[model samples]
Target: MDYLPLAQALADQLHADGIPEHIASLFRRVPRHAFLPDVMWGDGRTRYDRAEDPDGWMRAAYSDQPLTTQVDDGAEGGPGIATSSSSAPSVMARMLTAARIEPGHRVMEIGTGTGYHAALLCELVGDIRVTTIEIDQEVADRAHSALIAEDYAPELVTADAEKLASIGDGRHHRIIATCQVAEIPEAWLVQLHARGRLITPWAPTPGAPAGVLAVLEDCGGDVQGRFEGSLAFMWARGQRRGGHMVPDVDAVPDRITHADGDPRTLLDGETGLLMSLLVPGWAHGMAMEPGASEPHVWAVSTRCGSWARMHPDGRVEQFGPRRLAEEFAGALTWWRGEGRPTVDDFGLTVTADGCRSVWLREPRAELWTLHAADHDDADDVG
Candidate 1:
């Protein structure tokens, strides 16, 4: 029944990962089970219930992996699709450490989720200094209930994280987002105080499946920081494909344009990271068919109804209004020109004049300013 030993075990992993001792100390104190729901999306995409499997539930609660708490914005239940989850403990350690939370610091957490991290934040910086925002009411209600039950009452606001800084009157010394963001919203910049740090997972594009961690430090209204590491949190619900993404990979192509290029190189690892950053609105994936010589590499546009695929022979096929394969070629050429920069060779800078830019080598001499994601899934939405 005791989870401290389990919590300590998780903390030990964080220590090994080089998470600071103070952060590990807080990880040791918080009981993760209290913040989790009775039912969680478990391994193999199945539900783990406390009543049916109490022992299994405790094991999962204290385990190192993420446990999904909501699916399809909580509209559809069971293990269909995960829209939210308690982040893995190791990631929590890194983000919390990167946040640099200190005494008297006001911290704003963008996505409250189960409030597990918010509770940890409260324990670190005091309840009065923490403000957490959640979009889903049922999820927020549950988190609120849990926090209250534990006697940690930091401000809980149920609203879209993108819209909060608009009405926020107070400045935050530290701002951490659990959700994945495509472009850093202007509001997040407004709420961040000078010398504050805004830590978030900036996905090239995927409703927060996984992406590099950006640790931007505030100087006046502008922020200067680089990608610190990788994180795999759920994307904010509003930013989800129409609020969360569900790609139509197997859908019959509307049209196929024969192109010549090898897109297989851009679908899986570090190079995939580059593809995402270079070409903003498309989601890339791989499907291995049984008895096939090579896996099918696929890319679908999150906007404009475009798709691209590369067969084993290096022949490329593109569908819809845009030639996604050609876009891939351009991106590849750009990356090659840049010396095939790794994810580490990148960083982001937001100027006080309110211009947001992505950079290479350093924050100055801005590389490009990302535009607002075109959520025009009008053709794909059914």
Candidate 2:
């Protein structure tokens, strides 16, 4: 249970991972083992373990990483799933980098899973300037007690972070959410100070693998931004339900045309990356589940009655009882024509009431908007 050596090794790993010097120093100083629970799982063993054990808890605590503590809590069968967790160190670092936190800056963080990130923030900036919110009361209380034990306390609010504007006085310099949002919540944009940055994982369309990191800018009243990187996170509270049912491909219409294309090419291609770069709004890439035995496939809800299947030999088959295959084909065609830009090509612009993402290309400059005041309306632009 040697803590110092564990911390030193974690610091070394983070440095090698490109974490900044000042931030790495903060990791070095923080007592990560103190933030974890006394009885925890490690190396396949579930028991009362010492937090400072180098090959045990300390490795997980100090490494720029995430660890799962709970799955489905309060579900029909005890904890239903690993619905929430402490984020990975590298992922948190990427988020902090995207957040661009500065000394003395007022920061608000959503989804205080294990309070590890909050502790990191408290170490980076004094606790007074940091505010963290969590929805689960039990989790929040646990995090609160853990932070208190380490003497690194920040304002921990047991509430939904999407409603941050209700608890905070005014705007904050930076706002970050570890949870994935289907769309940018308006409360976030409204509570952000001018020029402030909001970073969150934008959930993928219905059946996509992971979400995208959206970096938004707050102008007077509007907030605008684009996807920066690919990330996989648990869906935010509101988006975590009702969509787990498997889609029925056979129930769809059969108006789609079988075309010749590489299935692996479509799955592993740069189409999604390019679309996000060229088109400012949310974009996705999907393939049909290969066969009953092959589990890869592409289908868009917009073409609910249709689906496209990629074969092992670089061939594509579009079949369904309905005929939205044209739309699917067109969308794919459009994505291919757009030069396949990556997430870095998008930029954000914010205004007093809303935000917009504009593609910097010529002729047909594409744009998408989200409005802050109309967030509750679901369809409001930011």
The candidate maximizing lDDT is: 1
TM-score winner:
1
Question: 142 in model 1: Cα distance from truth in Å?
Answer: 1.0
lDDT (Cα, 0-100) at 142 in candidate 1: 95
Error of 1 at 323 (Å): 5.4
- Name the runs in model 1 displaced over 4 angstroms: 76-79, 165-168, 206-210, 242-262, 285-295, 300-307, 319-340, 351-355, 371-382
**TM-score to true structure, per model:** 0.83, 0.79
Q: Candidate 2, after superposition: displacement of residue 142 in Å? A: 0.7
For candidate 2, the clash count comes to 44
- Model 2 gets an lDDT of 0.63
Error of 1 at 272 (Å): 0.7
Candidate 2 at 54: error in angstroms? 8.0
The window of 10 residues in a row where model 2 has the poorest summed lDDT is 373-382
